[model samples]
Target: MTRSPGAGLHLHLDPLGGAAGDMFVAAMLDAFPELEPRVMADVIAILPPEAGQAELSRGQSGGLAVRRFALLPNRRGEEAKPRGHQHEHDHGHGHGHHHHATTYHALRTRIETAPLSQGTAAAAAAILHHIALAEAHVHDMPLDEVHFHELADWDALMDVTAAGSICAALEGATWSLTPLPLGGGLVRTAHGALPVPTPATARILQGYEWHDDGIGGERVTPTGAAILAHVTGGTAGTRRGGRLRAVGMGAGTRDLDDRPNILRVTAFAASSGAGADRIVQLACDLDDMTGEEIAAAADALRAHPGVADLVLVSLLGKKGRPATRMELMVYPAAEAAVAAAIFDLTSSLGLRRTELDRLILPRSATISVEGIRVKRADRPSGATAKAESDDLVHAPTLRARRQLAHRTETG
Candidate 1:
């Protein structure tokens, strides 16, 4: 689908309620129709040995016809080992040490060399790196040297690569996510029994907002955390003004009583005239400053180069004393400059700053300079000219600089 220049895209991640890689890949496929076959091949190739014989099938669940890749652990001529003794006594387990690094590296190589877009490859690499880094930190080893026992499993490799491919396909879109659900309970892994949302998962969830649903089991895995962390910018909340286009649900391996074990992802298209908009909100209150100084400070703040919007209000403070409230909205990258300007131009001791999501219209502006018209070009509607000045004033836009170079070449 062709999107306008300022279109907004929304992506939602259902962490605690979904399957690991399967849910992620399914959601992406729902958004991009062309990713199905490539993802299926990756999934089939990476089926972990522990999963036994893996097969892909189509089925309907929750009124949606979807692809279900089911993996059955090899059971022929083998009996289930006792829970506690399985690790040490089972001869079929093969290697004493898990070759996680070798498996992950091989999978990564396959993904990197796959017939995929550049964006897809880079995104897949990033997800793998996140998983590897978490494992490395947990084992107290360098990221490149540490092995990923669980994540390196074939299933994980397929899921992550498919996800990367989907993300790469949507190159120019922005992703917004909802709050993640972190299910409650304990989970068993190679590292022994640990609380649900293990240390690695916790690290990934550190700055994000999440709620615990009292369900027992591993709701979110390291692979799931890695994928969410790589895509969702570690922030969660609602977005307004975007129209929901498509939604996909991916089911988990196990069933739960409270809710269906599934992940839901939704895609959105921004309303017309909506462009990329971000605002930095700055606020400070002071009771000591005189009215004159307060007015001066407000004027200076408005004059600052980076300040886009500014506000000042008077309010009653503690003990019925009057205080001035100063607030400013500016571009995200210009936050530091706005803050510096406030400090230099005001008498408040400290300021509070926050980043806000905003929608802006597409815009362009022009400036005039005194220079010779070295080059001229005629468009279907209007004529454009490029000029050069011997004295350097300010660096021109890249387009302007390119035009100047073209003029020089022709001359």
Candidate 2:
């Protein structure tokens, strides 16, 4: 049987050892091994000129083997050496980088210049933006003034970018995350000692549920928190239920006594009775369009054969300019056509699209008053029936149609 467009993909994350950029990326790769070439290539292609190659391998934690990611940069210690050589760095920093620390501004520029797909680049920048914001606030400095320092290293950068690329790889899947584990005791930071979860990590993880598992050490790092904050939109899932499609275990560098330092990623398929379906929203900011122009565009789109619906909202776009954001939804099969139509109808050269799971009422049908035999859907007091609205041209009156519908329902 054919399925409707609403049947979409859902992703659930189990950050057992708390989420970090590498763990998140590694876990996702573990879940979808086929993505290694495509995902990793983009990371390598877009990295700063100074970065080396990225290496993903299997590692064990708490006796469980999991996917571990590291950056094997081109530069080396005194001499260029083979990959997998352990270098000096802190816990938050992944693998090792021989490059100098970059400022938040320079990092942002580097990401923008990278030749990445639309989705991957935006996601990468967004994850970094969270880190930058948190760091700026923690130091009470301007955003541009904030130096990435530990966060700017190749491993951290790769982790951050890989996290974004992972999200891009899971393009059509809705993302949901479990609450992070807040490890007990103090954690060492570049500045000094701080409570577990680290202040910057805590700041970026606002709105997410957290609980310390009574273990001693730092579970969530700023890089991890920033990735979660950006990827999950700062919201953690209370519960997600569906048929499992895939699962990946990402191993953290260190080992834990009780729990495996692994992040588990699971994919779920869309199901019925929950009123949930897969959805993709395409939006573009229209700063130059007049009210009439916007309305005309909407009218044209609403009439498109593939478009499901559209909404024009007033908002502030780049540089505080007044803009109208035109958001539209369509069936998965219609996505490409709809995007092409938007380009022809508006001034937007590019549009943003996000795949999501949307809950809709459990019902079915069609309606057409002009048809010789129209089809309409009606649920009266828990009972469902296909109703035919009044047709003065064909039917005698409204009451007569209801009587006919009642007889059909009773039968």
Candidate 3:
């Protein structure tokens, strides 16, 4: 059977040693080797012929086989040198640039204008933007003034872009991550010896959960942090339930005696029927607020990134007061934030909260048709498509809007 695009896909990251850009790409490619050629081609297409080359090699970590990705940058007429994950300068600011440094703006422009798929370019640009934000925060400088130091070479670019390509390939996949291991130690950089998880890396992973494992080294590099930040959206948490589909191990440069330096990535598939999951539901009734105030509150709740879905309904309250009852559904991880948002946005003094089991049917992602994005779902009857009503906000007439939606869904 031909699988629909983005159907029932889930990805979980287990950063055993730590995460780096190279390891992220390698692990993803290892799991989906079929994507390797296309990823490499995209990377090469964006980069100049003389810039360098990217390759994947088989290696072993603790006697277990793994795949490693490296960027070999061409130096003059000499053969390209492979800058592996062990090189601190790959993400550190300590090294003096042997070549002209590229600004964050330039890098973003390069990636954005590169000959790559729309999804890959957008993903790669977002990842670079995350890194730029971290760097700007660390240096206390304007984003434009921040020049590429550690990532000046093609090494960081390849790692990040490859990671972006992998993410693009896995679009519609639910991404989750394990708590990262906080390795303790001093790392040498342009600013001299600094604590492990370098300044930029720390900033990039500000909200992420980390636990010290007594393993001392650069666990998560800045590039890795940016990639994770992009994936988790700063809401790093444990994996959800799903059926395992594939697994891949990506090895780093250094192999420790106590543990292997490898990252494990696992892909999962949503089951054939509705999947059972737990979610939090909060409800509140308000009779004292004006319609405008209630509408504003509901809008705020709906706009919150943590909120899954929200509904408002008319109801009769005490004294036969006309009131609006607001109900919000959110995942357990986001319940606290959503609850706080409710209190901040509404005039309600109290809320009714409940943990509910919800069954979700597997659905495909929204795809653009005739420049209109349409969502699709699989049903026993067949497949169905629904055009987003928001896309018709500018329509001249209701009949025209209906006609456009019908064409988008049917075509």
RMSD of each: 12.5, 19.4, 6.1
TM-score of 1: 0.60
lDDT, candidate 1, 1-411, per-residue tens: 233222245565555354466666755665555667665555454444454554455565554455454343467732222223221101101122332444446556666666664455666766776666676676777655655556434445556666766655553344545556666666655667667677767765565556667765666667677777666534333343367877776666565665656677777775444455667899998788898898888887776645667888889988989998998987565578678878887877798988887755422111111112222222223333344454123547767766654543232
Model 3 TM = 0.71
Clashing pairs in 3: 94-190
lDDT of 2 by residue, 1-411 (tens): 122222345677888877777788888898888878877777876665555678899878788778888776565553222244332112453223335447877777777677765456666776787777788898999988987755645667777777767765553344567667877776554566667666678788865666667766767778888767654544453235577878889877776778888888887665543445676789999999888988998999876645657998899989999999999987565679789989998999899999877865333222111211222122222324344444333557778666666553332
lDDT of each: 0.57, 0.66, 0.74
Q: If scored against the real structure, what TM-score would every candidate get?
A: 0.60, 0.61, 0.71
Off by over 4 Å in 2: 1-7, 48-50, 73-90, 93-98, 272-411
Positional deviation of residue 361's Cα in model 1 after best superposition, in angstroms: 7.8
- Runs in model 3 deviating more than 4 A are 1-4, 73-100, 272-274, 280-354, 360-411
lDDT of 3 at 253: 83
Weakest 10 consecutive residues, lDDT, candidate 1? 86-95
**What's the number of clashes in each of the models?**
2, 3, 1
Task: Give the lDDT ranking, best first.
Answer: 3, 2, 1
Tens digits of per-residue lDDT, candidate 3, 1-411, equal 233344576678999978988888889988999999879988897767776788799989988889998866665763333333335423344254534347887887788778886477767876887777778888899987777665666767878788878776765455678878888778766567889888889888875668888877788888888888776655553355787888999888877678878889888887765667788899999998899998888888876756768999998998998989999987687788788888888888999999998876555333232335565565444456788788778779999999989876654
Q: Rank the candidates by TM-score, best first.
A: 3, 2, 1
